[model samples]
Target: MRKHRRIIAAFLLTAVAVGAVNTPAAASPAIDRGALLAQHPLTTYESGAEVGSALTAAGFHTPSSRYGVSLHQLVYRTVDAHGRPTAASGLLVLPRTGDRHLRTVSFGHGTSVYRGDAPSVAPDDMFLSGPAITFASTGFAAVAPDYLGLGAGAGPHPWMDVPTETSASLDLLRAARTFVARQGRTLDREVYAAGFSQGASAALGLARALQGGADPWFRPAAVAPISGAYAMRRVEIPAVFTPEVTPKLGAAYMAYLLSSYDRLHDIYRDPRDVFAAGYTGMGELFDASHPGPEVIAGVPDSVGELLTPRGRELLLHPNARFAAALREADSVCEWQPAVPVRLYVSPGDEQAVTGNATACRSSFAARGARVPAVDVGVDRSFSGMVHEGAELLAVPRIAEWFSALAGSH
Candidate 1:
């Protein structure tokens, strides 16, 4: 982390609504709701070498063959979870060299506790920028949305809110196209999506939304999401109590998820209802300003200790309303993906609880949508094998997978 700098991203809620504005249901027009508020040049990497250096600093390696590229931070208009008009900021990495028939790859970034990890804010952050460079430097137009609450957006981030996550991503795709066109460049109109960790779930949701005709013009070509917690109620939620998993990480995730969920649904009237008195200040952690480790340190040794007895019971055997929210967030792979889709996983991954990939594959298969759950072999320590290792090793492989799909499109 480069001294966490708050870059005062210019956020403006413009007049344009993201989807079709006041259009008839039958007349599904493609609408670009993400209005560009401001654009700032972040940096221009002269070649793959420069991109690699940045990636290394962010704890990763870049793709072997790279192209000179320019990165820009964009503040644009999009709606929030409530469908109210809001603003978001993200990054657009444009390759200086490549085919004139440029296509766009919408990358959903992985988990980051601090708001500073946002692609637009920390352009060199590996989680976002490394993948951005990997895709863009390989001759594709890469766009990484900071999501609704992260980056320059206001309020607490919805860590895994499926609908808003999908909408924000879709809006960014629209924004990217609008921005690219202004530069006298035309895109192939095909959008491919990939993500890791939390982003994997977002990518899956985005794929479902796009396939269901969220955007009439940008059809999905292929989607690959790596090491994601797709099954929350069945696997992810319960795993917090298991000793093998990192209790601190689980506690941090629960704090983020539950606090954000409370805002969307009135599940709890007070923090004490869902969290123990020991976890009084957990709400402050989700302001999107704190770092992951610091947030984790604030949590109890186990998530169970942080939750009230009633809260634990409710979460473990969630009531109708609570369960519904969990189901909605976990329903990433429920819909079929018309395009080629793959769920990359590490069988050895300790971060993600068991059954996430299995459940996703099963859901897709039950719908007669045969999607592969590819296992990316683990070659790192179990600590590394948790999440970051899976991301570091799997991103380039996913990029290669996307490249192979190019000819089919």
Candidate 2:
């Protein structure tokens, strides 16, 4: 029996090393309740055409051949076998230079807003260039999804709510595979996910969905969660509400809640504070105050500029519960990984409490994940904090780390 436990542990460690979680011996509730993984509704190239229409509306279009390489851009939609509305839209961002073993990295993009401001655009939106293009430039078949709502239809971006988002995510990849297969092109399951900020939330959601649920193709080659949020309990929105939290922090929190729980508009400190008074939209209000980019100059002081009196009152509600669900929603450790797991978080990050990474590390450690929690360059002036502090330094380190671990396999 002791030898058997050691074998199970060894297999789990191997799986974690590869970023996959082995399914449990017994059936789990998440699988029993949510939409299980299945095939996409579309099978042929002609049927996959409508996805282009969705892409055009989202301000993304296939690249006209430039400088020798060609790129394809389109929005894709499909209903899973379970009938959940799963959709994906992203850029193929490159012209095939050669027949390289086109590696694919389906980025789990950061969090997004409902409809107000510009930044609220889905994280996968090309306008927000960060990770999608970076990986594409490095020779990976990068795929990004607008999730279910940010670019899909309406209501509930889910905020790491798991079930729906994971379903949409897994199916999006399945859809991509189907699209590629129809074109007579092939790509490796070298398929991986690098989730940052809110994208980390999406990554974990998809990871849990693939861990042991009834499918095999859903497995990711490796997963790296940078400044990952493990459970909603660590997501403290009230911390952002305090005066010391800064305008950017408060604005992000209020805007997120406004979208996540729109029905509670009446309870806001000032409805206009979050969204414009006449505003009925679901995304953030991208204004002079809500600028793009994480640069210090871009952080706004006017997050509260659009507030209505009632909005302020609602925001001030001390008993708010948004933070609770965000942290409590995920369990990266409970579900073991089949591939290696890597976690990156700055020791000095002001946005996410230090404990967030600690929790994720704890879970990974328990499940036998070969976790190496690296600093985001916050403490290393030698590593350089300047602008990338966490975001910049973390990206390449992620590439290097994954390379070293995968070589072992």
Candidate 3:
């Protein structure tokens, strides 16, 4: 395996308050929130065995022996028997101690071609070896789960499924709390779910679901979903192709929805067949099934249809109908906390639905969320740069945000 340099993303809070406004909310103490753990690596091969061990060796194991560090790392299990969606099972990681009931952070990951893993990587198990331990080093317990198939070796990761990922997010958080409590440690039930790319979409969906209805378990103090795919239902996949930002983002999306909806599979027959012998089967079938962007990045037009039959099946399925109805019936962004929410975005992110932050702010405002957002370019040299650091930067701002609201976490 080639060694790729890991970008050690160190993001701390900036701007006590905009306009140099010295409000009480901007005057909170600086908390040592850890590093950022959001990025989709470009890989041609992935094996759970390899990734898992890497995480283990990184000191991501649960119930650890290290001091000033209480860590637990293990693969959580969940069964998706019925037509239900994935559960964020597999490879859970967290820090060992927080005398002051630790605040938990659940990360939503980006695209992986295969469905068996929800935004999963290979055998290296870098969640612990890479970011989870880094997070622990920063004094925060982290819960990172394989959305469904990947770690457990299940087939197909259910990308962008709301209920499944949402529960996974909250359940992981709940599980972490329970794990600590069982070990005679305590954790602040208050948590925040954050993600980037599709994982960001997952985080957004989970946040909405948890808060949109009568949640049995009280939700976190706030939601900080960045670079999310909140508006996937109406994106123009046909308009994407190549190095242009449009196609770069559209490639995996094309493969993902196509992989899920069998009906649409044939519509995107590999155009290469014309030259490859007048075609016998799809060129895609010849490629590996991992959901990496590279595999899908350079495919031909036959693979890039706008209206696919499989999409029709997904659109017409009973659950699909239920989704439409639920969306129409509720029609609101459900924020779990009665407190405030902080939406973050980069203006130059061509991968995102344009004006997403604006639309979100407008829509969420009517729903009663105190959202203080910063609309910046995609080039944030500091920690709050990308779509994943919503809460990362907010931790410092939390003491600031909560201090003003007199909130408790």
Among these predictions, the greatest TM-score belongs to: 1
Q: Tell me the spans in candidate 2 whose CA falls farther than 4 Å from its real position.
A: 1-71, 78-86, 93-97, 114-127, 152-156, 241-244, 262-328, 379-389, 404-409
Q: Write the per-residue lDDT of candidate 1 for residues 90-162, one digit (tens) a residue.
A: 8898998845668888888876666666787777555567787888877889888888767766667887888
Best by lDDT: 1
Tens-digit per-residue lDDT, 137-220, candidate 2: 444555555554443223334445555556556655665565556556655656567776666766766666666563465456
Per-candidate TM equals 0.89, 0.61, 0.60
> Candidate 3's residue-wise lDDT over 1-409, tens digit each?
0112122221101111111222233343331111111222222212333333443454333222231332343333232323232223333344433455666556665545443323233323342123333334345565665564433324455445555555555545555555656657666655566555555556566556656552465355555555555544433232233333344335445444444433222333334322233222223532334434344434433433432444333333324443453343223243434645666565555555545555556667766765656553344322222332332332333223323332342
For each candidate, C-alpha RMSD in Å?
4.4, 13.9, 14.5
Q: Of models 2 and 3, which has the larger lDDT?
A: 2
Cα deviation of 397 in candidate 1 (Å)? 0.8
- Whose lDDT is higher: candidate 1's or candidate 3's? 1
lDDT value for model 1: 0.75
Ranking by lDDT: 1, 2, 3
Candidate 3 stretches greater than 4 Å from native: 1-72, 79-93, 96-100, 114-135, 212-218, 234-244, 261-294, 301-337, 368-370, 380-409
lDDT of 2: 0.47
Query: How many clashing residue pairs, candidate 2?
Result: 52
